[model samples]
Target: MSEPDVSKVLRLFKEEVKVINVGLEYFYKELRKQGVNAAHVIWQPKPELEKDLEDILKKIL
Candidate 1:
């Protein structure tokens, strides 16, 4: 494998970093602490899935 062009890597490094933090708020907090643009999105299991798998989950739990 060959190394990437240095100029391209440098341009990417200069660009602003934006993140979509899904599921976990911890990652978003860490990113904010580092002066990164971070957005948080709530993630959870779909209600339909819970309804469909309730029987199996009950048995397992």
Candidate 2:
């Protein structure tokens, strides 16, 4: 729509925006530089869980 939704816009302007950046330090830094709340989580797959096994686990779980 051309015009913004009033309530949504008001909440955005009034509330603090939060962001969780996983596996990307750049995005977290940029978000902080822009003054938004940000948390960076470093993540990696388990060493024993190979790609094929991981895929099967995803299907089963």
Candidate 3:
């Protein structure tokens, strides 16, 4: 709820995704240790952000 907790949760999500991509079990474990909840932190698509992200992806591709 607080700023630092929100930041930590966000950071953990990124680390978890990286772990998942490389199949790093320990990193995933560490993310859980930091009290990151996947349901809470994993991004959900919003209309505006989703559009922006799609644009960015198109550019990258």
Error of 3 at 36 (Å): 0.6
lDDT string for model 2 (41-60, tens) is 99887578778999999999
Q: List model 3 lDDT by residue over 8-28, tens digit each.
A: 778777774432313455655
TM-score of each: 0.54, 0.51, 0.26
Worst 10 residues of 2 by lDDT: 1-10
User: Candidates 1 and 3: which is better by TM-score?
Assistant: 1
Query: lDDT tens digits, residues 1-61, model 1?
Result: 9977799779879998788999888998999999998899989877675565898888899
In terms of TM-score, the best-performing candidate is: 1
- Those runs of model 2 whose alpha carbons end farther than 4 Å from true positions after fitting are 1-14, 49-61
lDDT of each: 0.86, 0.88, 0.58
List candidate 3 segments past 4 Å from native. Answer: 1-22, 39-61
RMSD of each: 7.7, 5.4, 12.9
Give the poorly placed runs of model 1, Cα more than 4 Å off.
1-14, 49-61
Evaluated against the true structure, the overall lDDT of model 2 is: 0.88
